[model samples]
Target chain A: MILDVDFHSGVPIYRQIVRQVQRLILSGILGEGHQMESVRDLSGRLKVNPMTISKAYSILESEGLLQRRRGIGLFVAPLAESRKASQSKALFDALLSDVAAAAVQMDVDLPQIISGLTEHYQKIHSQKEK
Target chain B: MILDVDFHSGVPIYRQIVRQVQRLILSGILGEGHQMESVRDLSGRLKVNPMTISKAYSILESEGLLQRRRGIGLFVAPLAESRKASQSKALFDALLSDVAAAAVQMDVDLPQIISGLTEHYQKIHSQKEK
Candidate 1:
C-alpha cells in the first residue's frame, strides 16, 4: 500500500515492507484469510520493483505472515500474531546480544545492563497499560 | 568484545556491532575519548572478518556516534546522545510509515492507528516514569 515509503533510510526496503505488513497484521488491519494484493499489483501501486515487493512478501511468508493460497492470492495467514511474537523474540535477542557486547567493550558488566534493562523495561511495560 | 555474536541473525553483523557500540556510549560506559580496540583486534577476538568490524565503525562514525582521532584510535564521540536521538527518530519514522500502510491495506483510516498509537504511547510513557 501507499505508506509514502522512505527509500533513503539505513533500513532496507524489504525490511520496511516487512515491518509495514507486520504492523498491519498486529493492528488487525489485515486479518486472517484476508487477501493481499498480488506482488505485481502492489508493485504497480507502490511504484517499487516486483522483486522488492516479492522480497518483502517472501520474507514475511517465511516468517509465517503471508500464506500462499494455491491460485487465488496472498492471503493474510492465521499465524500472523505468533509470527510477530517470534519476530519480537528475534529482535530482543539481538538487543540483548548487543547490550552484552557493549558491556564487554565498555568494560562494564552484563549485570549492569540487565539491571538497567529490567528497571526500564518494567517502567515501560507498566506505562503501556495506561 | 566477546558479546557472543550470532552469525545466523537476519540482521547484518555490522549493524549488530554498531548497535553494541551505541548502547555502550548511550549508557555512559564508553565515555568521550574512550579508545576502541583496532578493527583487527576486535576481528581477531570475535573471529569475524576485519572488514566487518571496520564497516561497523565506519557506519557509526558517519552517524556521528564515533570520531576518528588522527593516529590515536577510534574515540567515543561526544555526539553519542544526539546520534541516539537521531537513530530513534529514524526508527519512529519507519514505524509510522509502516503503520500507515497497514491502515490503508486494512481499509482502516490512519486516524485509528494514530489514536491507538497516541493512547498506547501515552500509557507507556506515563508508566516509564514510574
Candidate 2:
C-alpha cells in the first residue's frame, strides 16, 4: 500500500495515485485479494483530499484492478492476476513508443540508444538491489 | 514548424507545443537560424489561442532554444548546435529514467526490457524510413 504524491507535478494527484496503484497491482507487489488501505487512511497518509483518493479508487475499480467488498474495504481484484501479462505488455508498449519517439527525434541511432538503455538499466537495477 | 496538440490530454496545450518544438529543434528538423512561423499564423494553423503559442515560444526563448530578432521574427538560437549533444543527453537520461522506473515497477527484468526496446526501436526506425 506504499504510495506517494507530488503536488508540484502538473499531473493531477488522483491520476498519479491511480497510476501508482495500477503499477503496484500489475507488478504483483500488491497481490490479488490484498486489501487496500481505506480511503480515509490513504488520504491522510498522502495528505491528499479523501475525494481525490476515492476518485482514484473508483477509476481503478472501473478498470477492474480493484474490487469493493461490502463493508470490508477495497481489495485487489482477482482478475488482476490473469490480466497481469497483457496489462504489463500494454504498459511497456506505451512506454517504448514514447522512448522511440524521443530517441528518433534526438537522432539517437539504435546502437547508441540500446547501449544507453543497458547502462541505465544496470544502474537502476543495482541501486534497487542495494 | 510542424506541431500538434491534444487538447484531451491532461498535459497543458502550451507545454505540448513547447515539447514538440523543442524536439524539432534538438533533432535538427528546425536548424539553427531557421525562422519560426509568426505567432498569429501558427496559432491560426493550430487553431489555438495566439497567447498559448506566445507563451510556448517565450518559454523556449527563455530557454535559449528560440531567439527573438527585434522585429524580424523568432529564429532558432545559434547556440542550439553546440548545446545539442548535452541537451540531447539530458533529455535521453530523463527519458531512460522514466523507462527504468516503469520497468522496475512492472517487475520487468533487464533482459526482457532490452529485448522489448530493441524490437520497438526497429519498428519505429523502419516506420520512419518508410
Candidate 3:
C-alpha cells in the first residue's frame, strides 16, 4: 500500500512497481483477495504512466500472485499468502549472507553481530508492544 | 570473486554483477587495491557479453568502489573498505525492514523471529568455528 518510487535508481519504473506490489502482498498488508488499485487510478495517483502500471500488473498476474476478473480490477490470489513463506525465507537467506559477509570483512565478529541482532530484535519487539 | 548471474531474474545482468562484486569487496575476498579480472576474461568466464561486464565496472568506478588504471586493469579502491561500513548499514537496514514486514504480515510474532534469528546465528557461528 505504501509504494514509493525513485525514478533515478536506474531500475525500471515498471519493475519497481511490480516489486513493491509483491512486497505489499507478501507482507500481508494486502491480504489474499484484496483488490489492487486500478491501473488508471494508481498511475494518476503515482504520477506515472498508466501503461507502466499496467505492465507491472500484467507481470504480477503472470506470476499467479494477482488475478483479474472480466469487469473487475486485479486482486491478490488465494495462494499468494501461502507461497510467501518460502519467498520470504529465500529473501532472508540472501540478506543474511550479505550482512554476514560484510561483517566478516569489517572484522566485526560473529558474537558482535549476534549481540547486535539480539538488541535490535528486542528494541523492535518492545516498540511494537507499545 | 564468485559471481553468479541468474538470467531468469528480472534484475539486469550488469546490475547483478555489480552487486556481487560489491559484496565480494565488502566481504574482504577482494581487498583494497586488489585488481579485478579483466573485462574480456571475466566476460569469457561468465559467458556474458563483455559490454555488460564493462558496464558493471564503469558503474562501480562511478560509485568510487573501483579504480581503473590507464594501462593496467581495474582495482578495488583504497577507501572502498572503509566506506563500506556505512553502505553495509544501509543495506542491513533495508533487509531488516523487508524481513520484518514479511514476518508481520504472516502474523509471526517478534519473539519467534528473535528466537529464530538467535538459533540461526548460533548455527552459523558454530559452522564458522568448524
Candidate 4:
C-alpha cells in the first residue's frame, strides 16, 4: 500500500497517517496478523518523525485495530477485517445525516442526492468489475 | 439554535463546537451577516470555558466562514451561505471515494449501497414533504 502524505492540507500529519493506515487495513491490503512496518522504518520512508508514526500506531492500537506483542512488532488485529463492515455502516449513517441536513437546508430534494449516489456507485462498481 | 454538548464523546469539545456551528451555517439556520451569540453568552449557556468557544470562533474566522467586526462581534460571512453548496460537494466527493474504496474491499455490490441510499433518501423526502 502506498502512503501519501499531504503536508500542507491543514490536517495534522499524525491524523493523515492514521487515516491512511485505516484505509489500507479496511481495504484488505493489510490483512489480519500482517505485521506492520516498524515505526522507525515507516518514519524513515515517510520522512516524518518516529514519534509521529508511533503516535498513529498507538492510536490505532487503542482502537483495537492493531495489537503489539511484547518485545515484538505490531500486527493487525484478528477482528479488524470483520469490523470494517459495521464501522463503514456507522460512518455512512453519520455522514448521511450530515449530508441530508445540508441538502434540506439548500432546498435540494433527497432525490438529487440519491441520484448522485447511484451514479457514483455505478461508476465505481463498473470500474471494479472490469 | 440549541447547543448540546456531549462531555464524553471522545471528540474534543472545541471541535465538536466547530462542527455544530458549521452544520448550522451550512443548513441555513445561520445566514450571512447573522450576528452570533457572544462568546461569553455561549460559554455560559453551554457550561464550557469561554476560551474553548473563542477557539472555535477563531478557527471558523480563519477559514473565512465568519467575520469579526471591530468592537462588536463575529457574524456569519457574506459568502458562507453561498459556499455551502460547493463545500458540500467537495465533502461528498471525498467521503464517496473513501466509501467506494472500502466497498471494493468488502466485495459489497454497488447495487446494495445504491438501493440503501434510495431507501434513506425516500424516507427523508417523504417526511420533509409532509
Among the numbered candidates, top TM-score falls to 2
Q: How accurate locally is residue A101 in candidate 2, as Cα lDDT from 0 to 100?
A: 74
Calculate candidate 2's fnat: 0.64
Q: What's the CA error at residue A43 for candidate 2, in Å?
A: 3.1
lDDT of each: 0.64, 0.85, 0.73, 0.74
**Tens digit per residue, CA lDDT, model 2, B1-130:** 5575788976789998898888888878888889999999999999999999999999999999998999899999886455887886887888888788777777788788778887888887787788
Candidate 3 regions off by >4 Å? Answer: A26-32, A80-130, B80-84, B91-94, B97-130
Q: Which stretches of candidate 4 lie over 4 Å from their true place?
A: A59-72, A80-109, A115-130, B2-6, B9-12, B59-64, B67-74, B80-88, B91-109, B114-130
DockQ score of the complex predicted as candidate 1 = 0.11
| Model 4, span A17-130: residue lDDT tens | 887787667656788999999999999998999999999999999988899997899999877434786875665555455555445544456566666666776687787678
Candidate 1 per-residue lDDT over residues A1-130, each given as its tens digit: 4354667776787787887677667556677889988988888888889999899988889878789888888888886456655554444333333333333444344343334434444444455347
Tell me the tens digit of each residue's lDDT in model 4 across B45-117: 9899999999999999998879999789999987743478687566555555555554554455667666665
Measured over the true interface residues after superposition, the C-alpha RMSD of each candidate is 12.3, 1.4, 4.5, 4.2
Error of 4 at B111 (Å): 3.6
Question: What is the Cα-based TM-score of model 3?
Answer: 0.69
Report fnat in order of the candidates: 0.10, 0.64, 0.12, 0.19
Instruction: Please provide, for model 3 over A1-130, each residue's C-alpha lDDT reduced to its tens digit, 9 standing for 90 to 100.
Output: 5576878978899987887787667656688889999999999988999999999999999988899986999999877445687775655555556555444434456565655665565565566567
Model 4's i-RMS, to one decimal, reads 4.2
lDDT of 2 by residue, A1-130 (tens): 5565879977799998899888888888898889999999999999888999999999999998999998999999886345797886897888888888778766788788778877887787787787
Q: Give the runs in model 2 whose Cα sits over 4 Å from its true position.
A: A80-82, B80-82
Q: Candidate 1 at A112: error in angstroms?
A: 17
Residue pairs in collision within model 2: none
